[model samples]
Target chain A: MSECIVITSGKGGVGKTTTTANLGVALAQQGHTVAVVDADIGLRNLDVILGLENRIVYDLVHVIEGECRLKQGLIKDKRLDGLSLLPAAQTRDKNAVTPDQMRKLVAELKEHFDYVLVDCPAGIEQGFKNAVAGADKAIIVTTPEVSAIRDADRIIGMVEAAELPEPQLIINRFRAKMVQSGDMMNKEDILEILAIPLLGVVPDHEDIIVSANRGVPVAFDDESLVGEAYRRIGRRLGGEPDVPLLDLTVDDGLWTTIKRWMGLAPAREVAR
Target chain B: MSNPAPARVGGGAPVVVRTLSAQSGADGVIVSVRVDVAFDDVRAELHRVLGQTPERWRNRMARLDLGDRDVELFDVRRLVHLLKGDYGLSVTAVYTTERAVHRYVSRELKLQVFTRDPADDCVQALVGAVGEAGATAVTEVGPHAIDSDGVTEIVSGPAVTVEDTTSFETDDDVVEDDGAIADLSYDDESGAAKAAPEPEPDVVLPVEPMPIRIAGGQRVQSIPRSLRGGQSVRFPGDVVVYGDVNPGAVVEAGGNILVFGALRGLAHAGSHGDEAAVIMAFDLRPTQLRIGGRIAFQGLEDDIPRGPGFRPEIAFVTDERIRIEPWRGRLPTEQVATGDAPPSTKTPGDAAEAAPVTEQ
Candidate 1:
């Protein structure tokens, strides 16, 4: 049966949309029909990230408002065969979609797809409610930073308040080298604060930025470390065994070490 | 101007002293005497007015010139005293050494002089002259003290004594002795309206009549309202409902809940925060349920189960995970009954409970 999963993080800029795009791509690549619905209405960016902005013939608001059929609004992604998107309307506000309407839409999608991943907006406002309304489960994405973890904890409380199924945690953009150097908070510390089951850790990587800028999700790039991380997160969503996080630290050679000591050349940046 | 006034009485003298008769000013009496004396005499007069010894005065006087005249004065203390005395009169001293004469005059003086006989009559006449709006001037003759009693009588209102006129009544007149303003009437035949039954002294009925033991050596502290048959139920501990619980019903217990029935109404388990608390219904349907935080229907779904033992259930989360589980046929009863239900217990059953009929 298809499962409606909402990827939500209470704090903004915590990789919620990125996770939704990558997970949907990863799920679709595994031969499962997947639909990524962007719940952030007026501030729509999911279509841009998926590089399907120009292909949008109808939006979610038009479908919900009865101006367009649900099938008319479903944009099939050319990158992946089974992957489709229900882009949020940039012209309309969040009030254009009701939780009941979202529930009905997700229910309809559940019949055809193996996964319906909703990209919830930041904050615990109406957008969040609309996104989480029809979800069978949730994936809370958070960074290792204190504020992000705190917000994730608040989101966990909210998800629990909604009485949805238990949510899994995906710690995104973790800096392993910084964690080793004691400069960054570790995954264990994040889990201690959030107190939710850990699904996977996504390392910080420049390729993720490159892929995001090019409107291609990192999960599609098998060679990229962050891309592999996104694939592991997708496998985890499919109830696969836990995959170890990537080691992002750069090895120091003698010349590199000497340059580091001389403060001439910078130390290697961590990879995702 | 006729004959140059035959050189006025104290004119052209370095020191001029004028003593006018008492009937000169507007009050018909000159209470102040102006004297234009030498600097030394002026200093002596100042010392006298201030009741200070002449030795206390400084010899070197400060010279002050008014227009073209120079006057030497020791201090301004004497002028201050004259202004504050009878009739509130003031004086200005002028010493014209260049002109060879000093002129001194009372700046503004109006005094009422007193006579020994018919002194009260003069006082009365002064009072009448001042009336309510004009200035009232009264002078007493000799060393006699002024009668303050008459002034006090005219200014003050008459005094009267107040007594506590409130009367007391016997208890019989006031029925229902609580003293509240409720209608208090004593009908001899109708037994003195009982004191509204002293609020039935906080009867602490045992909330938990019987406790049921669950797993982990934790006992269900209160009996489940479902088993209690529809009685206004309150459990001292946790209540476990085993059947379809009804609405307009209450289930309060001290421990936790494991309902095999569809929980329809208010279900409060661990009314206190026994972090080990939980609430699990087979159908998992309820109007409102509270383990701790107030929970209302976030949304209602029609696909919920209706009958008993159709779906297994368990709920428990303390500072960590809040979970619900469906009873699989293979799982032990104690596993579902205890607070330590497995995380994987939530399963979708084919025989889903019918939609809970919620009372509007």
Candidate 2:
């Protein structure tokens, strides 16, 4: 039984694309056949994030419009086996595809892959609607900001209204040091408003940005904490509910390290 | 464009601009434009000088002090158009010594003109302006308008005139229409007539307060689910919701509004005009609260901070203004006696006190 999940965040720049790319690699690394479909249409980024941008001869639009077969559009990941990408059309508008076409496409992809992950676009527009059309479940992504939470709450309401099962949440770009200092919001604050099940929280780290710039998914690196975070979330999505959350506070160290950076602590001998 | 040779202007004289200085005035600025060039260059040079004003000065009323040059009627018209259209300045009055310009600009453009009298007529208007209310002018604060020891400043230009005597210590907040105030006084008309009254500077038309109306609810609407952003519920009667009202959602009713859960959205009770309408929420952190025509924006961060932590609040009109206080419980059954006072110890305000007999 293949379950297709659409990863969405109503607000842009909240890591919908990054979550889709990393989770796809995480699932593929677990030896499961996965096909991550980019539903952002004109703003297709799953191909770029998965480092499969250059190899696209056909796209989701071509598949939907019957110009090419579904196999012609699926780009295999450069690094991992059993992982493929159905990239959205860069030249076509979002209106080029319909919700029925997406449902049909996902139904076909499910026959070949174990799991199909659809990367949704930002906003509650037509592209968002088309992305949600084919998904069996949804994974909402949000940051610790008020605007992100507000939009997430709105997206959750929309997902329920669309009759999708209670969507799980992934709080991305979390900074533990800021949340610990009482400056930023913690997981409890977001969960209180959203009242949804938590898939995981990806700590804000340089690895994600470095991977994005280098056209590589962070999930390829097993040592990175953020990579582990995505891997845990992937396991949760894969029906392994016992995967524990990663310890994000390991980077925040003690107060001395914080004070030393601020040049406020008393002179302590440098150990290193 | 390569810094053209000292340009020969009117009367075959190659004139050049001398100095330019700006002084901050009430709600705007007063620019003292001193130039040896003729009046034809005032508009062109004004652009070069005041083109990129400070961020605050942009779109504000700017005063320009054009030198005592031969200002024709057409010159005033073009200068007014350029200053208004190009620089976004509201020129209030024009002061000129040319009696003929005084005749035409006042008749054709309807601009006010003033003389450079330091002691007699100028001081009389200053005293009158100071008496017209406790209007706080910059003159009283910095005392920059007038020089003590009874001395007037003769700013060097086409004509030596008292420039500081014009920036008055008068009704600083009075508002007036658009026209430039040129201060070129002639010895012939020094004591001939009164100075054109200072432009009315400060009178922003105050918005009239919305009058609260009296009306009862016709029906009661019950909503079982939470309202998300872009969703709204409007009814002609009271509204009761069983779920949270998320941000960007709206709940409007003609009578009272009660939310069982948090209200992060907007709640407008008394939509028709019931001033006695009250809004009670389990966790009241609405973006805006409206009781009748009165509106109170939840702008203060301390009043309704985002995130979790509930201290149920009830909003009602109590002294012509909507006031919010802690809500203990609702007396929905009318069980309390009419004459009995509300228990002040445990309750800040009960729902019975906020809801009047609107069912007339």
Candidate 3:
């Protein structure tokens, strides 16, 4: 039986779409047929990240309306054989599909696929309801910032109310260096507040931005730290054993040398 | 589809199989097949078809008998396929058997046999049985009853009287023809109309209103500027510093105050205020101190420490007496450079330095 999972976060710009795209690619690489559904509707970006924007002739809305068959609307990934995408319509609003219709569509898709991953929209609204209506499980993405954690807590409450199964948390854009320096909140602090199982952490990396711009998920790039992290997340979801977190500690000598060479380091302010 | 040839025996009287086919165009087909045979042989045949002996077949078949056994087999898969495959016959039917005949036909042979019984129609028979037992057998409701009749009845009497005496008022006035009153009158046998007289006007004597007292304390009006005395004046709450209190002004506050620059004002610690309330200044040169209800004047004998130019200082009641202290302490830069301080406390100093400072 197929398991539908929704990747969501209450706050925007927390890498929900990026996580969705990367996880889809990673799961597909494992030979599981995966379909990534972008439920952001009018503000669709999953297609762009997957680099399949130009190929989207018929979208989710069209398929739901019987204007096109599901097979016709599904965009097969050029890079990954087992991964496909059902892009949201940019012209239509979120109201175009109801939760019941989404449930029906997902039920129909469950017969043919092993995993259906949905990219949920920001905020706990109708779009969120529609995205999670058919999902068997959920993945909540959050940053270590106070506002992001607070919003994630609210989203967790909402998901609980919807009667969905427990949601695992993926801390995104975590700067381990800052966290070590006490400048940012740590993983334990976020998890303690959210009270959810930690899936895997995706460190902040420039390669992610580059890959996203190129419409290729970083998971395909084995050399990238974030790409490896995404792959580990996929494995964990596949019921694999625990994987260690990425060591983000930079060498003190290297950090100091770089700072000294750039003259960007500030002298400690003295007060009496 | 054609029906299979009947099983035959040459010794006994020729058994004629009469097949009655009724094609109710819209309603559906009802075909009946009658066969005459011995009772013992028919029982064995039923056992073979149902895949169980008599005891095991009880749940499968509702009614059974030795001779003239009327088995209402509804849409039997093996029998229907036989009828369609061998004999080109498409019909629904009920079968009635007065006797049993199990003359074995070849394994390859197929027969289309219809039994005239309610059980011949799968859905119809099941529905009919459930209906006969007066049970609502809906697909969705299953065995669970959809509607229940056990309802709770609330025994209600006259409502409890809750008199709102606070809002009640009595009025006395000359009787006037106004429709304001409710019509509580009932018809008399004589058809004569009668009405109750209006109530007398009530006189409400005015009572003295209670004095309004502030919850915390009375607001202290602004102190007169001309009433300047070096004697420390303590307040119960905030002291509003309107003008510059000179170094010898010796003003004290119970809480906090806003001083508009040049706090050369010798504000004493704690006026009528709590002892913990402090005296702050852009420049700290207080001549006297007082906290709560206590007053302490600066003596000539007390030695004061010279600062590396005191920027701002706040003096509060410490050790049960006012003590002046400088506000400077270890800064963020010093902490970061030393690395001895907790790393978490070391945020970029620029962000910390940008924090707004308010004097009150």
Candidate 4:
């Protein structure tokens, strides 16, 4: 059965698009036919992040208006045959396509693809509504900062109002060092405020930025730790409940253990 | 507009066809037609009357008046069908002196019928006003003319003497404006009829002072989700928000406001000058708050201490200034009105009792 999941966040620059792209790649890698829809419209970035921006001859608006066939507008991923990208139109705004139109498109896409991942825009406006309109589930991405957590809370309420099932949270760009030093909010603090199911966390990593800039999703990079996090999230999304949540604490091989033994590093809490 | 004169039909005896306009109690205009001839003559007279009237007044409420005549239901139904189907008039009322015809029209046809010699004067006035031509329907004396004495007697009777010692002056202005003239006047009389349970203000208000919760109880509008930036909801009464009011969002109400979540946005309660209205929220970190004539502007950097923990607070107008108190089943008396009153002799018990009751 096809499942539509919208990746949304009320705050901008919180990695909703990146999460959608990586999740799409990871799901496709598992042999599932996936269609990643960019619901951002005027601020389309999913195409560029998926390295399929140059291949778009027809966009979401064209497909919705019947100017182009759905297959014609779908840009097949260069790396994976099972994966495709429905690019948003750069010329049109969020209001160009309504929630009803988006629902119809998602319903049609569900007939062909096993997974339809909708990349929602930043604000909880028309773009967010369009993305969540047809989704069976939702994934809210947020940072550990107060502002991000607050916005995430607002988004969770909005998603609930849209009648979508309670969304899972993904803490993006988390800094273990800051959390350990009490400089930033810990996972527990964020969890207490959001009070949603935890999907997976992607720690702050430079490789993710580099991969995004290269138009390659971090999920495809085997050597990248962040990519592995995306893989775990994808498996969880694929109904693999046994997949362990990523540990945001520093995981520097034998160094951390040796330092702990030598009393050089502070004792690690094994509460979990 | 003189009542349409009786028109004469050629070949047959002269057919008397008269059309009269009456005003229903509900302010709707009702046109009545009296036919003193056969069914065929009535049709011809109706056509002549319809031709004489303007198009705007054609499809108005029409009533067929059979003055003391025993007409058959079939012929009446046919005439009603002609009025409704052909003339496009909504035949709501049927005036006939026959009791069987009245009962049939009221029951089977489901039309209002007024028989001759209406028992009650009030009912007579109402029925007479509906049947009589000219602007008598708009005279506003139909129900009042009969009920005025009963009302005044009930209002100025024992209840007025045993309770309020002050001279009561009836405010006639309250009688106008709202269409619930009958209900409101009755309520006013009943309110005066009841013995005053507590000492009230000197000026006798037409209506009893209603509790905010009961009077406008269902007027509570709720925003089930967070109001994002640039979004706003304006309600004429109390508002309850289940989600956070985001920084740039706004929620305005004409009465008390309650937020189940954080109030980070601009919230204005008591918008229409109800100073007693209060705004309560789980987290009251609003950017700005306006209650009636008072305004409280709070910034992000403003240091409102929450010592150990933050509790839900209520913002209300106290001594003509905005005061926010940690709502722990009641407003804290220790928490003095900031920027206005110092620690006063009023204890917490006094504050708790004073929160709900406000003197005019």
Q: Score the docking of each candidate (DockQ).
A: 0.01, 0.31, 0.01, 0.09
| Model 1 error, position A69 (Å) | 1.4
True contacts kept of each: 0.00, 0.32, 0.00, 0.05
What digit string (tens of lDDT, one per residue) describes model 1 on residues A90-179? Answer: 998888888999999899989888999999999988999999999999999999886786577667767876899768898888776677
RMSD of each: 34.9, 17.9, 38.4, 20.0
Task: Give the alpha carbon lDDT tens digit for every residue of B83-140 in model 1.
Answer: 3342233332221211211111111111111211111122222223323323322221
* Model 2 chain B poorest 10 in a row by lDDT: B174-183
What lDDT does each candidate get?
0.54, 0.66, 0.54, 0.66
- Cα lDDT tens digits, model 4, B1-360, are 233233222223212222222322332333333334567766764555454443533566655555444455556777778767766777776555444344345544677765543222122233334333323222121122222321211111110111222111222432332233334233344346654223222111112222232224456787787675556887656788998787677887666678888787889876544455678898888989987546799965774644557888988876768888888665444333322233145422223224434422
Distance from true position, residue B342, model 3, in Å?
Answer: 42
Candidate 3 lDDT over residue span A41-155, tens digit each: 9999999999999999999999999999999999999888889999999999899999999999898777778999999999878899999999999999999897787677678
Worst 10 residues of 1 chain B by lDDT: B351-360
Grade the docking of candidate 1: incorrect
Best first by TM-score, ranked = 2, 4, 3, 1
List residue ranges in candidate 2 displaced over 4 A: A253-272, B1-218, B303-310, B330-360
- Candidate achieving the largest TM-score: 2
Q: If you score just chain A, what TM-score does every candidate get?
A: 0.90, 0.93, 0.91, 0.94
Model 3 - which docking category? incorrect
State in Å the error of residue B191, model 1.
Answer: 32
- Best-first order by lDDT: 4, 2, 1, 3
**What digit string (tens of lDDT, one per residue) describes model 4 on residues A48-164?**
899988899999999999999999999999798799999999999999999999999999999999999999999878898899999999999999887887788788878877888
DockQ of 1: 0.01
Which prediction has more favorable TM-score, 2 or 3?
2
